[model samples]
Target chain A: MVDPTESPATGSSIRHEDHGDDLRTVRLAGRLDMLGMEPIALKFTSLTASHAQQVLVDLREVSFLASIGIRSIVSSARALESKGGRMALLVAPGSTVEATLTSTGISEVIPIHTEEAEALAGLGAAG
Target chain B: MAALTPADELHIQPDPETLRTASLWLAERCRQRSVPQELIDRLDLCLNEVLANLIDHAGPGVLEIPVELVLDPGDRRGGTPLSLRVRDGGAPFDPTAAPSPTAPTVLAETGIGGLGLVMVRRFCDEMHYRRVNDFNELTLLLAWPQETPDR
Candidate 1:
């Protein structure tokens, strides 16, 4: 059976693919805001508690990032960090996530990846 | 000399979905009164700002504390003005006195926080506050465009 926590929105396959070795990948799209973000946060919370290495959030498909969405990402990052892990993001070129980060000064705090492979490679947990 | 609607004093601490439903109702009320879309949009953004701020700063209560929204169609803008005060009992800091942020360089995150007040300022004329007793009295003032003389 497919684990329910791994899937995001229905009809669209928003999968958090397990890369094993404590690294995971998730894809996002459309507008990510307060309404569509709680579940994503819950999933990250669940995974990060058990695995204490790192989680890669892929915003390559996400168009916009709101304040609420940023809150969730940061909250999850702190949760993992407490357990000796970290969070990085894979951002698409010219996406709003970059502006949101830089504007909020998270580009200096929240690590960014231009490509998914690069993020996994950076974690050195590449599978 | 007109009386305020009964909703003038209604206070509800609602979750996201219920809060959204209530917001739709509020929008319909504004639309019925011909409030401009721009003003309505601002009101909606104001709701998001206060609610998100409350959640961020006002949790861990063991039991869910009521996130209060107090209505005071209390004749602020003559008879047509409805007033809303969304208060967060969290950390007790006044956003009114909080420093401003217009560009990226002006912001510094103590950690994971910066954008809420930014969006809030973009949407409202002013955020008023007074610390009364122990709770934060955050008053977000929004005037309906229909109520404006030249709007």
Candidate 2:
């Protein structure tokens, strides 16, 4: 769990790790609402703005995900997709990740799974 | 015939903390009324987005708004019309009349600086606007929040 004490101004935290060739993983937690969506958007924009080719957003620790947060994710995904890259969201069990994915109608466009491993594997295979 | 309905006005700074707290409190108020999930969902979204925009554009000032909640048996469907009137002492602008982004516009795709009022108008039943005494009154009405059936 990302300590709320040290979280960003939006009260959302970002943790990224390089998975494989041009693949990136980013973890997000805490309430991702309007105020929180700001930093999240910047973080994502910066991450996909780099030389990275693929980005996977991990929301396993996210407590709440709002439309603004969804917009950030979709924006980042579109940016990557424009470059022939891919964006995937890793959602944990009982998380509203499925609804967020469905709300944006991105589930059909992107891949989501119950576990990070499953989501990463799906993305790895898709990529 | 007389009924007991509660209506009150609140004044608070447009600070983000105050705005979020007020909206969250309003959500709790809706829950206490046992509003259905559907109504609650809309209220939750509208409350946050509306207030966020209010504080952002309205700048730092006292938000003089009236919140009127009525629990009426007028509708047999167990839904009561919810009225939320937000009057701000800010610049003269009506968001309801704002034009929506053009279809699939590449600009809208960025999704960084748009879609707040659009979503509210899309989800709410009716939004009334009036400017009086140098105050912008935004009367928002939504389909009644589902209430519990009389036992």
Which pairs clash in the backbone of model 1?
none
State the local distance difference test value for candidate 2. Answer: 0.63
Q: If you assessed candidate 2 against the hidden native complex, which CAPRI class would it receive?
A: acceptable
Question: What TM value does model 1 have?
Answer: 0.52
DockQ-based CAPRI category assigned to the predicted complex of candidate 1: incorrect
Q: In candidate 2, which residue ranges exceed 4 Å CA deviation?
A: A1-11, A38-41, A59-71, A90-122, B1-4, B59-79, B103-111, B145-151
Tell how far residue A36 is off in model 1, in angstroms.
2.5
DockQ, candidate 1, vs. native dimer: 0.14
True contacts kept of each: 0.18, 0.07
